[model samples]
Target: MQFCDECGSMMKADGDRMVCTNEACAASSERDSDLEDQFVTTESQSDDDVIESTEDANFEGKPKSTDVVCDECGTQEAWYTLKQTASADEPPTRFFKCTECGHRWREYN
Candidate 1:
């Protein structure tokens, strides 16, 4: 990632150029091709992969009772956990799995 020359903040890609994310600075520059090659991209997980990973992380081994209503099977019982998905100041996201149909969903507080 390139740093903004004006504000010294990390610049983000905007089409063929890099733009400063800081609203106060709002500076933009051409994106270097060599730097683009060094940019890291996160590998997306498939549905099966995500499900397998979640199942493997079932520390309690049993579904916990929750008041969340499942969208798939309209079940009222679910297993829930808090996952940190954003910055430290932001609230942890809630992930839920329906006990009846195994449907998964996320709720942001």
Candidate 2:
């Protein structure tokens, strides 16, 4: 990951140069030829298959299940959790996340 020297914003690859992602920062620098762009990908899984997951730092330790489907991607597996968004007497909201495409949804009991 590269950062802009002028505004300290994150930089993305643009051909052989590292261009700043910040719209306001026009800073750019030459990229190393040896530094190849890395892209991690995963194979799709069936609805009744194993719970798919990633090694992303933020995704670590999150509980997952296959009880829901994503409206955007139609994946049948997802990571799930619950939260109390309403009054104490009310039921907690059940949130769901698509394991395939990272889509989020919620359910009220």
TM-score of each: 0.44, 0.43
Predicted structure with the largest lDDT when compared to the true one: 1
**lDDT for predicted candidate 1 compared with the true structure:** 0.73
Off by over 4 Å in 1: 1-65
lDDT of 1 by residue, 1-109 (tens): 5789999998887778889989989999888887766885333324432322265455244447667899999989888777678999999887787777777788899
lDDT of 2 by residue, 17-47 (tens): 7889899888888877666545211223244
For candidate 1, the per-residue lDDT at 16 reads 84
Alpha-carbon local distance difference test for all models: 0.73, 0.69
